[model samples]
Each structure stands twice: as structure tokens, then as C-alpha cells.
Target chain A: MNKEIGPIEDLIKKLNRLPGIGSKTAQRLAYHIIEMEDVEVADLANSIIRAKKDTKQCSICMNYADSDPCEICSNNSRDDSIICVVESPKDVEAMERSLSFRGKYHVLHGVISPLKGKTAEDVTINQLLKRIENGNVKEVIVATNPTVDGDTTARYIQNILEKYDDLIISRIGYGLPVGGDLEYYDEITISTAIQNRRKLD
Target chain B: MNKEIGPIEDLIKKLNRLPGIGSKTAQRLAYHIIEMEDVEVADLANSIIRAKKDTKQCSICMNYADSDPCEICSNNSRDDSIICVVESPKDVEAMERSLSFRGKYHVLHGVISPLKGKTAEDVTINQLLKRIENGNVKEVIVATNPTVDGDTTARYIQNILEKYDDLIISRIGYGLPVGGDLEYYDEITISTAIQNRRKLD
Candidate 1:
């Protein structure tokens, strides 16, 4: 019945475009949507539109926010001397979830991926360098993911920031995840975790 | 940062309501939604709203459709005398994908299950009986899923349909799925497949 170009089919196609969603999942989502109240469905639709329109790129950290400087950048308690550099706003959320870092963040919006034709210019590399060169920032933490692009991006940023004599650039270590089984870890992860083993307090 | 009831957080909550979407998946979908063009995301939202607004239950078969009687029920190409009974709209889509059934469908919207407190009154059993009695229907195919609930529903329908001496009521066979491995099939499937084996041409 949905083989026709009806609204249900259209919704399915649109839902399938989201990451990790396939045709089957999209279909299920569409059916579930039909079951929801009209007001609730409208709220969902309006939420998406409002999120895009109201959320701006934070001038300091480049994280998406309703305010210009963002909550993190404006917070006086957060350390201004230390800045954690990440690939995206989602990474900022991940770091925040850990609740360990009480410093500022710089969102690159993406990593350096040669395969995808993304280079330093494509990301916020120049802005990161400018922040360091402006002085007062003591340490820079490269908190990119463990993927090839993330590592490449981290290395590239480190190389550039090394020119600033007072700036100390460090990388977030790749280690066995907390509570992860050693036997289940991949070879590369195990080796890296071993190589970057930290001294126990 | 998104722990706040911000736009991103709101979108995540909305996304999590969809079937099979957990909090993590919802977050991923929310981020993906932000990456998408405003027009595209708006289209997805509007499509869901439009689908619910436009599609109505067909009076005859009780399937969701743009108009009463639905396309299949009105189409002369479809076999009017033979009706396939299914639990949901998705099941009708599955049957249509096979292109095997030219006959129309009757969507009960749910299956009979005592655990869930569903009874003959809960589903469209009366409508199905009325359709058969009012029309010149020759046979009824029970195409509910192969779950415990599906089997229970099929058996209940069969018991009631027995009163109509002229109508033939049949259940779709339970067997090893075509191209499925014999070694991996459960005992019930293997046994049922053997018993339901038919004469080949």
C-alpha cells in the first residue's frame, strides 16, 4: 500500500536519511509516528526547526548553543588556562558526561580526513592556533577520537601549536576503556593502551 | 552540556520515542538531524504530520488508506472472494512485497492475546465476518505472524469461521523459511515443515 508516493512513503524516505537508520527502521518509525498524537508529532517537528534556528555556533568554543559564548565558555569556574580540543559538539557532550574536565573546549566540527578530502582548512585548525598564540592558555588537550582521521587531526594541530613556546600540547591517551574486558579489546587498542599506561595514584 | 532542556536535548527526547531507538541512538539521530538541511528535516516532520492527517481506516477492510474501501478493495484486478487477514498495516506491506496475494486485506490492527488482555472484541473480527457473510467470499487466509499470539488469534478465528459451511478457512503454513539452513532451524519448524510438506510438481 505504501509503495505509492504517499505521505507515509515520503516520511520513511526522510527518516532513512538519518544516520544508522535503514529502510526497515524508517518504516517502523513512520508507523510509530502515525500512532502518536497530532500535537506531540507537531512538537517534534517544531523542535527540529527551532533547534536549527535558535542554536548558534558559540563564538569561543564553536559548540552549538542558544547563546553566543555557550554555557561552558561563559562559566567562570571552568579553567581558561586549559582548553580541550574536540572534533564535534557531540564530543564535547561525551567529555562533559565524564565530568572530569573542568576547562574550556574548542570544537573543530570535524577531523582531518584525507579519504573524505577534508584538510586543516576544512576544520577549525586556524582558530585553534590563534587561541594558543593569543597567550594565557597554558596546556592544550587534543581529545579527538581514536580513528585515523582523529589521530591525523590531533597530530596536525600538535605540530602547528609546537611553534608557540609557552603552549604545552598533549593528546588524550588511547587506552582500554574503563570496565572493558582486555580479551575483547582489538590488537591496536591493547597495544596503544599498554604504550600509554599511566602511573597509578 | 546538553543535559539542559536545550534544543538538542529536546530533539533527542522526541527521537527516543520511535520504536527500537534508545537514548544513545536518539542522541545520534538528533545530531544527524542538526547536520541535515532545515528544509529536509522540516519535510520529514511535515510528512509525519501529513501521513496521520490524510490516512484513514478503510470501512470495509479496516486498513489505513487515503480513501474508504482503499485502493486494493476497489480495484477489480484484486480477487474479491479471497481475503488475507493480518494483524497490522506493516503485515499487509510485507504480504504485498511478495506480490503473491492478489486478493484484498483485512487489518485487525492487533492480534488476540490474553496476556495483553486482547479478545475477539479488541480486533476487527466482527468486520471480517460481516465482510464474508455480506459478500460472495469463498476463502479466508489467516496470515498473522508465526508468534504465540499470532497462532492463538488464528485458532480463535478458525473456530468461529467453522460455522460458515460454505467458507474455507486456512492458516498459512509454519515451516523452515525458504533458503534457511536446516541445521539452524528450531525443532518445531523442522517437525512442522516435514508434516506440512506438499506434493511437488
Candidate 2:
């Protein structure tokens, strides 16, 4: 049985509710929290509350933002003519870190996984269709993950976007990661990479 | 530039302040927090605040408690005459789990580590002395972790407690853990275990 007080026990219970955190991790984190200074603990609490309350969805791209149109959606420097669709806001951050994609983004929030109870309507596919309906977007890049669900979602979106006569639809390529060793790569990944091999420029 | 808005960025900063948590984990946790329901997020926030505000040191054992005396200190069933001295509340929880020591506890909060600027005076060593003085404490068990700092602190406490004519002072044994193979045991640990080996029935 745990020896922590009622409040500490309750804190552990609350922490355990988060995804990927188990009872042991929650208890450990709670113990660590109590050792911190009072002001720091208060700041942690304030940040959680603030993030929940302050963040809103970008009207255009559906990415999380402090304002209606997210930082990317509002910024005129980004290439609005090209829209990249991803699975979550975290993906948006990853793309931003690369500084490679200068275009805007549409967050699907999740891929369509029938087994996981996720359907086409659950994501922001409809919003994306409406956003690019005027044909201002010259190309649409489906940058979902390489998982089975991600592939299926990308294909589903591709089929719909193919209706636009002038819209150029593309999916990010599958290949061995830059730093990954060839010996460690799985059979399916190697085969897929070989099948999609391109001519060296 | 970070893609997340002000509150999300602030939350990531605050989360990064936690021990053992890095920038990537903080960002992942922040993204997870933002996606949670408002009430669940509020509960998590409230738990942190309440644990910080409500948890106080037990007057007797110095463990975190909702009340001053704490559950273990006030429980008459425990052997008050056997005072088990430990380094933290977490240690108390671990000892309790073992079910071997059904006694009272003294929390030192830290070991006397000169490198970390911790002295004998920094922990509750003085309070322990005062509590055991002219009292019914039959034996004092030093259950500090088996580290360089912990061993030094235990020896120092033992030297002082030895002055008492009738009091029995004991250090928890140094031996291979239960179910551990001697082949993988370090030299120091194997030698110590051999030196302290008991006569089997």
C-alpha cells in the first residue's frame, strides 16, 4: 500500500490518468513534485490550466493555436499555395523544426483507424476539403506516418483530392532514416524502400 | 521558432523543470495535456496544487501527511520502541512494503554529502537524537541506501548514538539481494556478503 497522504495519493491518481503514464511513473513523478519548491509546483499547475484554457483550434488549418488562425495559418511568409496534411499538432511541431516545409498545414488530429473506432468524419478531412475548394492550393502533400493506419488514411485522402482536376497530390516517400543502420532495418521497410527506389540526380 | 502558442510553450517550459524530464518528454506531455478534456486537465492541475498546499510534515516522523501526527505515528499497533531511521518518505514506504519492520520511523530527508553541500545538520538527525533521548526506544535501525554518502551518514549517526549506555544500534546488512546470482555480483558486494554470512539452520 502507498504511504503518501490523501492529497499526494490523489495527485498520483490524477497523474495516472494521462496516456503512457502508469501507476509507478505517476507515484514517482508525484514524489518528485513534492520535493520541488512551492512556487515551481504552482507554476506547473498554472501551466496545465493555462494551456487547457488558452489554446484554440486554428480556423483555417485546425492546428492548435492561441488565436483562431494559428501562427502558421496567420503567417504570410509561409507558402499558402501548398498545404501539407498531418495527423496531429505534434507533427506540426516536428515539421516546423525541420525548416524544410515552407507551406501551411492541416492537422487531421488522428488517422482513420476502424479498429480504433476512428473514422473519416472524426478527423478534419471535411474542413481541409472546404479550405482548398477554391483551387488556390496548387499541391496537397499527405505527410502522415508510415504505419498501416497512416497509409490507409493517406490513400483515402488521396482518392478524394484526386477529384480536383488541377490539384497535384503527393505522399512523402518511405525510406531508411538518415542515421539508421541498414542491418537494423526490418524486412518490410527495406523491401518498400527498394520498390520505391528513385534515380540518383 | 516554436510552433506551439504561448500557453503550450509555457507549459513545456514548466514541465522541463521537473527532474529526469527532458525537452522532448516535456513537449510530448504538453501536447498530451492540451488534448485532454477540460475537467480532467483541471483535476490534474488541482491535484498538483492541493498536494503542494495540503501535504505537511508529520510532527513525529517528518513524513508527508494530511494531519500532523500521520497515520503510522498515531497507529498503536506499530512497535514504537523500534525506531527505523531512513533517508526519505519514499524509503519509509519501501520498508513498510517489506513487512519485516513494523516500527516507527525517522526521516532524514537527505544524506550528509559534502559534494552536494548536505551536512548532518541539514537533515533531521538532530531531531532523531532528541526523540530517542531518555525515551523507550530499545533499538535504532539505520536503513539508509547502500551508497557512499548513505554509508558515511549511517556511520556518523552510529558513532553518536553509541554514547547511550542501554541503546542498541544496528546497520542494515550489506549482501546480495534475494534471488540475485553471485556471478553477476560486484566484488565489494560479494565480499561483504561473505563477511556477514549467517549460520544457516
Candidate 3:
């Protein structure tokens, strides 16, 4: 019953291998690609290839970027003394979107997941340590996700950075987000919110 | 707040242009693509380019294929006297998956959608007429979707083929799909099913 033509089938298979694309979505995308203008298709392909070829990890922060130092690392106006540690480059984008964090970022590339076989050695923790050791960084903020592996990675970083006598290690607050309702939040979040409660200023 | 890097943002915009891929999904896919091995990334890009470059509309049936006539049109064992007309290549694939349609296909590429300004001339209705006129075709199974445009296109085709006394133009049955419950079906589908009820054999 599998009577797909060669090029179409090949495209579908390639698309299906992506992170979130299912077989049905791959099929839809393949057909849409086939129907698109040749110039548009070429542009899409060129962008994919160009992005892969041009992008490199920032040597300092280990974040994916077009240059070695990355824009944030090169910018002197940003607070170089404070570094926000995150699991991926996308997290850096999220933090930047918030517009509140005026510091550099160190991308861990991944969290420490025992079940997934990702360890401290697998991530860019060594690069982060190297940055901290070489720079006059005063504060390190762990902005990894709030999942189990996120907490584990945060604690692991805190343990390793404890030797830095003057450096302040902080984890981003764990609680309901802005505009979130108490009733919609889970018990763990509610408890965490209560535990981290502060007096009115 | 828009401090995204050049190549990364370009890749995200290109990916976001694809159907069903939102900004968030595009970000995730872009990051995933960046993390992928160089060879895998090249393969993915190459496949996209190759699919577009190699594919051509079949001269006979207007279906996208690497070859001129397409596999289905060139297959000698398939019933040439009966043609299955569908709206797109994906629909042809769906019909092929059913394993019941043992005939060649005619891809309309689109249907007559007044809302979308797609008329009979926009689709390959002329190519279909050319196929019917030149061949010893006896039956044409209109397997277009059960949308308003689909019905309009099917009726338009029927009206055009009325001059051919020996031709059997039939619309594919529209009713509850296999494993579909009556309660779950919409009012229109339930009524259509009852209207087209067959004697139990």
C-alpha cells in the first residue's frame, strides 16, 4: 500500500525525523513544499543549510551564535559580573524577551538526566566553570527549567560553585508565573510559592 | 527586547513560514537543528533541495513526480479505462493507501473555490479533459474531498462530461468513515449516510 514516489517519500522521511514532526505532519509539509514556488523552496533550503554552516557556539558562553564571542558576551554595556546559566540557547532568548535580565548567559546545552544518560560531563559545565574561573563574575544565576533534571543540574552547579568565596549563586524563583491563578497551579507550585513568600516592601 | 542573532532568527522565520509550525515550534526546531550533527543537518537540507529540484509535474496526470508520466500513469497493470480524479497528490496517496482504486489518477491541483478565487481554469480541468478525450477511459471516479468546493468541482466536471454518452462519472460516497460511531458523526454526515444507505448483502 506504500506507493509514494521517490523524491516525495525521501522528503517526508527527512521531515519526519525532526523533533516534533509526526508522519501525518511530515506528509502535509512534504506536499505543501512540493506545491510551493521553486524560489521559496530554494530560500527555505538555503536558510536551513546556511544556518547550520554559519552558526557556531560562542566560545565564552557556549551559546549557539554566528560568532565566537556572541553578541551579549561582546557587549561591554551588559553586566559581565553577573552570568545567567541556562540549559539551551532558546532559554537565553526567553530571558532576553523578559527584558529584566541585564547579564551574560552560559548555555549548558542540556540538563543532567540520569535516565537519558546525560551527565555533567556531557553538558557544557566545564566551559561554564572555565568562564567563572577566568572572569570577575560576582553572581551566578541558574535559570534551568523547573523539572527534576533542572533542579538536579542547578544543585550540582551550586555544589561546584560553592568554593568561589565571594560569588553569590542563586536559582530563579519557583512559583506561579505572572497572570497565573492560584486555583490553576499544582500543589508543588503552591507550596513552593508559600515557602518562598516575602514580606511586602 | 529583540536581540536574536542573525542566522538563528533567519532560520526561525523560515521554519515559522511552514504550515502548522508556530513561532515556539520553530524556535524548538531551530535549536534542535543547530544541535544536530553536521552531516545530518546537511542531509536534511539536501533532501529539501533535492525534492524540489528533482520533482516535476507528470505530463499525463499533473501529479508531482521525478519522471514525466509518474509511476501510476506508467504502470501497465493498473486499469487505464477507469481514472480516479483527486484534488492533490496527498489525496492520490490516500486513495492508494485504501488499496481499492486500481486505476490511474488525475490531480486537479486545486478545486473550484469561489471564496479563495480558485476557478476551473486555475486547476487542471483542461488536462483532465485532454486525458479523457485522448484515452479509452470509461469511468472517472471523482475522489475529491467532501467540501463545498469539492462538490462544486465534481459537479462542474460532470456537467462538462455530459456530452460523452459512454462515460460513467461517479462521485465517491460520503458517509461515516470506517470505525466511526453514529453518535460521534455530525448531522450532515449522518443524514448523508442514511441518504446513501445500501441493501445489506
Candidate 4:
């Protein structure tokens, strides 16, 4: 008694499961896929499969890569002495987009959140510590998101690395974006930026 | 000298090619895929490839299906005598969701559009005619969208099938949708409803 034409419905259901895609959007996308040339559709599908199958996390930085050591980690030109610690691969991408960081990255995968039952132990923090302990790392920059969990995770990492007093550790500053007005910026961002403000010499 | 990570950028670019997915959304989704559990991400990737590889147009109705005839077309209980013609497989789904039609469907895949260079020959109109000529079909309901191309396609099909006067060919009537407001309704929709007004008798 099910009236739906089977394969199309199955595809829509699958598309709906993707993050941020709703039922209507899924339906639209399904229709678009069907309308596409067979080769184009097949290529799209193949790309998705290949992306998942061929990629893996770098053993060192935990960023997605085609090999054990990601391109960034293995690159000879990168500053191996400085590690930019971030919450996710997207944060790594964001930092890379800025073209400011020449140092390598360590992807935490997630930040500490008691509410979400995620602690420092649950993430790649141990791997990061191992990397630092193994060699000539001079600095660790905590570039996690400017959220509660991010701050907590950063603090935890700082406390753990405190034993290595010879190593320098810094945090990326939080504030209203360059073009953003103070009035439009959230209260927490304003307060955090003010609290963490550094004096000019 | 491209500061961007190659594979990550390529993945984001590929994701942006999907309908309605912008750069930011694509980046977010790409990152999400990167962060997902290996099995779950693999499943998503596999689903996309499987959908493309396994699905094809039902030879009879031109709707998407794994089988040549499609489940609906092959099903004995469906009213094969009455063919509800629609623009795409999604339209068939919408009709099914309403639970209003018991007949089998003929998906045109697209409507006639001179602007888009989509002629009657480009769609499955010939296949539909061939089905009707095979002789068991009693009625053909033109259920295309209420757009100009939709109406033109319906009219074109009606004209083409006019030779078979013995067959009953009809277009679904235009009316204000349930819970839709008259004031907010488009002029074309309201005008069409008025022009196609039904007689209660």
C-alpha cells in the first residue's frame, strides 16, 4: 500500500540524513540528481565514495589525509617547532585560509564539554602531548573555538603542559571581528576580548 | 604557492557543485564528513555511489528505479489503465504523499521549454504516446506543474493524443490550494483558477 516510487524515495531519505539538509531540500536535490546526466551523477557519487575511502587521519596531526602523515605534517618547509592546536579539521582549513600560520597543526577532533561527556582524554590531546614530548617542539598555540568547551580544553592542555616550563604556550585572542561593530557583537565576545586584552609596550 | 590545502579545497569545491549548497555550507559539510566516524562516513559515501550505479529510469514510466520496469509499473494492483503524467519522480512522490492517486505514473522528466531548448522530443512524450498506442490505457491525466512550460507541454500532449478520440485525456484542474490565502496567491494561479472554474452540476 506504500504509494512512493521506491528508489527516488530511498535516495531522498538518505539525502535528508545529511547535516543541514531538510526534507524539502533533500527532495529538490534528489530531483536535481535525477535530472543530471548519468555520467555527471556517477562522477558525483564516485567522488563521495572516493573521498571517504581514500582519506584517513594523519597519525601525527590527526587531520584528514591520504596518508599516515598528512601533507602539512610531512612538508619540509613547515615550522615543526610550533604546533597550532585546533578543535577540528575545519579549524585547520580556516587557519590555512588566512595564510598566516606556517607551523603544523594538531586536530583535537572536539573540545572538552562535560555536558556532552567529552573530556580532554576523549580527544586527540594525548597524541598531541606525545608529539610534544617526543621532540624539538618549542611552542603550542591553542587555536580552539572561542566557546566554553574550547576554553576549558585549552585550559586543561595548558595545565598539563605547565610541567614543560621551558616550552612557550599561547592562545589565539577572542574579539569582535575586524569589521564588526561592538554594539552588534555578542556580550560574551566583548567581555572575553576585554578580559584578555594585552598592554602595548 | 597556493597556500590552501589541495585535497580539502578540492573536496569543498566539489561539494559546492551540489544544488543550493553555497561555499560556507559546502565547507561545513566537507569538514563534517572529515570528522565523521569512519563507518558512518563510508556509508554515506557508499549510498551516493550505490544510488547512482543502481538506479535507472523505469523503461515503462520513466521514473527512477533499480529495475527496468520499476516496482510501481510492474505491480499488478496499480491501475495501469490510468497514467498520471508528472514532470519528475519527485512529483510522483508528492502525489503519493497526498494519497490521492492509485494510477501508475509517466515521468516527463521535464516540461517543454524553448528557452531551455527542451523540446517535446527531449522529454519522454514519445514514450508516453507509444504506451497509449499499445492500447490497454483508458485515461491520461496531465499533472504537470501550473507553470507556462507545464501548461504548454500538457496542451501539446493533448493535441498529439487528440487523434485517439476514444481515449479520455484530461488535465488536473487549477484551484486555490487548501489553507492557501487568496490575497497572497500569485495572479497567474488566481487567474488560472478563475478561467478553469468548475461547474458544481
| Highest-scoring model, TM-score | 1
Query: Which candidate should be chosen as best, given DockQ against the real structure?
Result: 3
* Collision pairs in model 3: none
TM-score of chain A of 2: 0.95
* DockQ comparison, 2 vs 4, better candidate: 2
Question: lDDT per residue, candidate 2, B60-84, as tens digits?
Answer: 8888878889889999999999887
- Segments of candidate 1 deviating more than 4 angstroms: A1-4, A176-201, B1-4
- lDDT tens digits by residue: candidate 3, A82-129: 888888787777667556678899999888999899999989999989
Query: Against the true structure, candidate 2 has what lDDT?
Result: 0.83
lDDT of 1 by residue, B1-201 (tens): 436588888888887877799987888777777778878877777787788888777999998877787888899989999999999989998999999999989999899999999998999999999998899999999999888999999999999999999899999878989899999989988998999999999
Model-by-model lDDT, in order? Answer: 0.82, 0.83, 0.86, 0.80
Ten-residue stretch with the least lDDT total in model 4 chain B: B192-201
Point out the worst 10-residue segment of candidate 1 chain B by lDDT. B1-10
Measured against the true chain A, the candidates' chain A TM-scores are: 0.84, 0.95, 0.85, 0.94
The order of the candidates by TM-score, greatest first, is 1, 3, 2, 4
lDDT of 3 by residue, B84-167 (tens): 899998888888899998999999999999999999999999999999899999999998889899999999999999999999
Question: Considering only N, C-alpha and C atoms within 3 Å, which residue pairs clash in candidate 1?
Answer: none
Model 4's DockQ score:
0.33
Q: In model 4, what are the clashing residue pairs, if there are any?
A: none
